[model samples]
Target chain A: MTLKKKQLIECQSLWKIFGQKAKTAMQAVKERNLTKEQVHNEFDCIVGVQNATFSVDEGEIFCIMGLSGSGKSTLIRHINRLIEPTSGEIFIDGENINNLNQTELREIRSSKIGMVFQNMALLPHKNVRENVAFALELRGIDKKSRDKVANETLETVELSGWGDRYPDELSGGMQQRVGLARAIAANPQILLMDEPFSALDPLIRRQLQDQFIELSQIMHKTTIFITHDLDEAIRIGQRIAIMKDGMLVQIGEPEDIVTDPVDDYVAKFVSGISNLHLVTAGKIMQSIAEYEASAGPVKEESLLKAKLDDDLDCLIDLSIKTDEPILIESESKIVGIVSKKTLLAGIQGHWNT
Target chain B: MADEVKFSILDPFSAIDIGIADWADGIKEWATNNREAIQPVKNYLNDVIIWMNDVLQALPPLITIACIAIISLQFAGKKVTGIVVICLVAIGFLDPRAWDLTMTTLSIVVTSVLISAIIGLPLGILAGKSDRFEQLIRPILDTMQTIPAFVYLVPVVMLVGIGNVSGVLVTIVFALPPLVRLTSLGIRQVNPSIVEAAKAFGASPSQILCKVELPLSAPSIMAGLNQTIMLALSMVVIASMIAVKGLGNEVLRAMGRLDAGKAIVGGAGIVLLAIVLDRITESFGLSKREKGVRHWWESGPIGLFYNQYKKLN
Candidate 1:
């Protein structure tokens, strides 16, 4: 209801230039405002991330979506300083990570952040338990304790009893679960997943996404999830950040991003995504007081009721039964109304606040 | 009758020398001049070789044969072990000296492999970690492997003089490259994603190397070690040119005297040794490559102790 959650991660104008003499090229870009293509042409330096600025709230899944070279992967790496930014500062809970020394940086990486990569990245030599316990092993945890933690995390990922098998012994989906288990075994406060499910078959990917959502709820690990798939971001993220050519195009709630993209690039990206299931009654409905005054009168008994959180698809199902407008209520109090017109507009991505 | 062209270009090929002979001569002179400075290394190697050779020679032939059979059984299985024992018995019956020669050859091969592993592993690991190191050493390793084995003997004879030490030294130089190459290759070929994942989890450089890179690269390293062992055995005969006696020396002598029967016997001994070592180490590498499963025989006799050890581990 209120925007009170503390920002767990903040990136301020982060830029990553990759090539020889990147520092000089970055300086020129900052002073003269050179375009990304121009920088590439002039200095032959590739800009991996450009002027990327955003924050992720505690316990929220912030999805960064883009085409392959859009720098979403590079951007997420900066949160833990895996890729050093040419310019800008990243703060995790207000601690400027870029300024931290190697030891401190390592400490933060080992203890504060857990990362899952697209390739699964399970050590081929390590069995499931060992791969999952790798972070703990790095921390110098005793074998027994780390194994105990690893086994428990394995169970959480639905990989119980497979701890003795090598990574190659498992199916692709199972191995990815081991990857997920490896990340969460350390119980780091933040999880950075860079297209962790992107490599799987669609059905397996969806199953993993569902499992991930359930796990995130139980673990409450603040996550910055990166993916190229818009549907994945929309399905899993609380807030989505869309990037193009190493720049953040828009960062907003999924419904807002889908229905009211700020520009054509964002709009085109969301164009293929159906808003029927995404847009909610709370987003499309008129205020209850205004609707009551304009439309006849509120009937106490006979009117069909729906929740503010009900999606357009659910409202459509509700609306098919009667001609009466659906009353959107929150906590047993009427908050707004989603009529047939509003439901259709919401489904078509034309609904706006 | 021929009109020679003045300042003929092809004439320089005959007159001018660009071979390594001068370098070898210069190194020999330098070592002789700095004999006091180099004596300690030579002395150390000599002592180590003497001790190793004595240990190998002290063991009764039957005991050594039985030990190899047991080890072969554990690794390569009963079939390979059966072949190994048959070879040993046949060698013993054919010529007692040949049997002893095979043992001496084994001693040299084992010691050289151990030394090569000690030197090659860290070098390989260093090369693996740094691309520049790999680039720098790549040409050198190529040169080492390509040069005739006899060329290695020249430097070894100069530095360490004649004995098992020189033999062992030459074998090391000949065999060392594979271990180094394979170790680096193995480490380099390790899945980059796995290393990145390890790094993302805050694994230190050493930790990533030891825990992730090395373990993943082990099959390659083992393959490299196998190559090193085979190459070392191959060089044993050439190594005997410098008076390092073994199956190689027997073969060399039998060839010199034109004794076909003796050469055949000596060559057979070497071949048998090669097969035994090859099968054992190859099987060991195969086991490591399996990742998770271990064959029942690899657990050793009774399997109870191995099961307990695995559990504890």
Candidate 2:
């Protein structure tokens, strides 16, 4: 945990109070340590983001998950200064974003970061080609080259040969792809996606999630993906930050958030999510030395061998076929062992690795 | 001149005198006194009207009709183009001089509509962007639309005097409100998320206005333009009272003598003119809707042509 990665975006104690007296309200809250509800009652102000702090590492998908009014979306907007914070500072690659002037902020938005929204904000008047090429065009990229780049980016999103059609001509799923294509067309260093696929049907949402996961690996762009859907967060996010009432409840890996949520709200949010697909063997496995000392695991060949990162579902499937405990391996070296009892405990969120 | 004595037109709702002949007379007197101050504006307005008239007169009737037919066919399609051709051809054959009359009315309408758009669109964009501006203009547009057309003409006649210049000025005043209102409406109706998207992508205010807001709101703005043109055409007959010659003059003269056939013919010409302008402008406005449908004719002739051209390219 102490081994720090290169932080691309670090937001410190960010607060955004949305009201006529937002600045005063924010000052009062900081001075008195007033709760969000207390500030609302005292100042008639609604807090959109409150004391939210998290860092997204380079090439990591940092997800913010919460319901409609959870401020997850509001928090991500601060990174690009779309919603300017009333107090606190945001640093993108160690440069404080809040201190930057309008021109610098715009430069960051146009060149450094790309954002996709829940509404799939493709211009209706623009054809798919023009829509995808818009960012490049804004940067004064030549039409011939930008169109080629747009076509290539569209193909990357599996939307080739659909460039000539307007957004209204495409299906909702196709439109979302075009949106993603547009964001990536400029080849920005970071991406901010605000529930980009929440409006889609579950089947399509899942498909896009899978594609995004693959795309993230190839593009390696630091992404702040906001969603209310826990399943989507678990599927794509390398780390998840859960927000409630404009405050960060917990920020952890999907396993940590699901298995060891810091509060009742987060626990409740993750209650319906099955750890079978989320929880990994490494998270619930007994230490290799401890297992060998107690159970005499001296054998080189094992019938049931599972990767440390293998989900509980795969471990369960393996355990059902045989009475032997599953051997957990990491980087081709046996790291730990997961017994059936541990699997049950892991399912019940009681096991601690 | 003898008909000027009949000034007591009564309202069904009330017996109050709606006539404002005295106000017109007073304004005229005031205008004459301030003639030097307004001379430059009056001269500029007259020059614009004269130029417009000369342009319309310069083109051959057949050529003008052919151009209108092609332009109409391109946008509104075969149905609208067919209607325009039939109506204009009927006018040409029925009365030889009617071609010149049609051209004159067209020149006035086109000039006024262009001027209305020039003034109205920027006002509409301002109103669309600012709540205060919208509130301020809303009442003014209401007054402009609701005021009796003939009543406003009195002030117009006083300022610009009579002839095609006065006709153009009056038409511009009458036709302006719709374009302004609709442009505001169009910009207001733009999806907030799309505007945010533009902002997120680092578009400047002007870029957002031009690239996102204006283009997205174009349908509504064009709709406003259509209404303005229709209103301008309607003003022609009224404009004829100030010696602005056109089909309106024919209609006014025919109506004065109670000549039914001539009145009907003049009215028909105006209707045909309206259909031509309405359809062409409407096609531009409905282009977005046309994009949604894959059918060739669903987008009208202009859309079909554009779609095919895109495929070929």
Candidate 3:
């Protein structure tokens, strides 16, 4: 966990305004500090992304979470240059992608990045295998090798025999699997998934999420996932960035966001999320000295013990069996203590110092 | 002041006439003077029409009927094939001259459709991709579509001279708009996300057009082709007034002689041909899903041979 990974994707002060007057609107925003609403009212331009900045580490699942129209989708599109930014710099693996020519951009896209859409968008005319192999076809790969790859990728997504079937013949969940298969078939280094499972039923969505997490673990492809659901972001993202009105409000780990929301906007989103598994013992624990001073010295043998990284759910389970406070250890030394009261506070979105 | 205003209103405002008619006449004069430049094109078109007509005429009537039946069976299935065969037989029985007239008309219709598709498809695709191009062509297409076929017939006869070639030229003018409009519409109507998805995967603009947009818009394009073929059929009859030989000429001659029987026979042949062509082309546009699980070689003459071969084995 302490291993240092290189940053693979970075965005610096990205801005995207829509409409014919976008250039003037962007200038107004920079010069006179116009708000999103003011820009829309004055210039008839809709702000898509507003000076957003973030980066993803290599092999990290970085999730951008926001409601519809918050520009999370727009922000993701900028990574692939699908929707060009009005102004900003994007670095992929230390290369400033904004400077890349169209051919270079396409070269990078074909070899390095893969994207899955919310709608699947699988070609109706193509059979599932052909659809999966389409990216390879674009790269001018031979039919035999690409089909081989497509079949293998399909098998990985548990769609072994469905390759010959057209997209419409498959169920919604199956179609989503085909979409995922298509993205990974080219063996791209980066994956951009835009709410890929949002259209499915809850049961199928969770199933696909689990499969995706398992796939990502084995592949270790750097990913930037976009979703409107906070729970989804919390579940899948190593780090979550929350956006509102085309601006990123806060970016942090799921535990950090849930336990310490930056403002009411994010607080409202996380308030409904169950953080039993997200709030760690290290986050809510008090100093071992402070705990001893308050309730006298505790015998470590009588109380259950947990590591610093153990979640509140674990602490709660440990606290149920024993009335004594649990000891939080890191590197084999007692660092902090979590009692039932502290566990309750952690569950209620409060952190004990 | 009131008297001056009344005089201004009554003045008729005839100061400027744009002189579009004079401009048109100037173009006609230029084309006539430069007729040699277009002679090769005219000769090539005439040869192709005559060649196609000869090929059709050389085939035995029974062979032609069988070919149509097999094709209909392959595309539109047994029911449509049956109706088409019955209609063809009926036309042939009603007028002994119907067969030859139908063949000539078919050749002309096919050639005109081929030329329209060749010209209209690229123009439509270009218009589809660029708003400015589409805007520029919109009024031209509207004018082409709205003007009566007879109006252009005069200009076309003057430029190309009266023959099957002029007939083709006029038919192209009449039929090209629908295909172009539909092709443009088809490209434009493709889902934006689908195009975006293709782009995200590193598809070039042309790659996106060929692999995604074109395939998705195929039904629309086919619909356009259907419309174009129908328009060409209608226009070919009108083109016969310029001495183009076909079922239309038969009807025209019969009309001059006041022979209702001959006219009805020609009309019947045209209708029968239209129905068969419409149904077959329509079948091509039907998605595989809608057409069910039938394989291409499983229902036509090929299928019959395959089944027999299987049984023999």
Which candidate's TM-score is highest? 3
- CA lDDT of every candidate: 0.87, 0.86, 0.90
Per-residue CA lDDT of candidate 2, range A71-182, in tens? 8888888888888889999999999988898888877788888989898999987889999988888777899999999999999999999998889778889999999998
For residues B1-313, write the lDDT of model 2, one tens digit per residue.
4743453556343444556866657876887677678778778877887787788889998898888887777666677778778877887776767777888888889889888989999999999999999999999989888887787677667766777887888788788999999999999999999988888888878888989999889889989999999999999998899998989999999999999988987888888778777777777677645635544354555676777988999
Off by over 4 Å in 1: A1-3, A281-310, A324-342, A351-353, B1-24, B289-298, B308-313
lDDT, ranked from best to worst = 3, 1, 2
Tell me model 2's lDDT, rounded to 2 decimals. 0.86
Give a tens-digit lDDT track for model 1, residues B219-266: 789899999999999998898899988899998999999999989988
TM-score of 2: 0.87
Candidate 2 wrong stretches, greater than 4 Å: A1-3, A277-342, B1-30, B288-313
Winner of 1 and 2 under DockQ: 1
lDDT of each residue in A93-113, candidate 1, tens digit only: 999998899888888888899
Give the C-alpha miss distance for residue A57 in model 2, angstroms.
0.9
Recovered native contacts, candidate 2: 0.59
Better of 1 and 3 by lDDT: 3
User: By TM-score, highest first, what's the ranking?
Assistant: 3, 1, 2
Candidate 3 clashes between residue pairs 3 or more apart in a chain or in different chains:
none
- Where does the lowest 10-residue lDDT sum fall in candidate 2 chain A? A294-303
Candidate 3, residue B66: lDDT: 91
Work out how many backbone clashes candidate 3 has: 0
Please give the fraction of native interface contacts (Cα pairs under 8 Å between A and B) kept by each candidate.
Answer: 0.77, 0.59, 0.84
Alpha carbon deviation, residue A100, candidate 3 (Å): 1.8
User: Model 3 off-target regions past 4 Å?
Assistant: A288-302, B1-28, B293-299, B302-313
Between candidates 2 and 3, the TM-score winner: 3
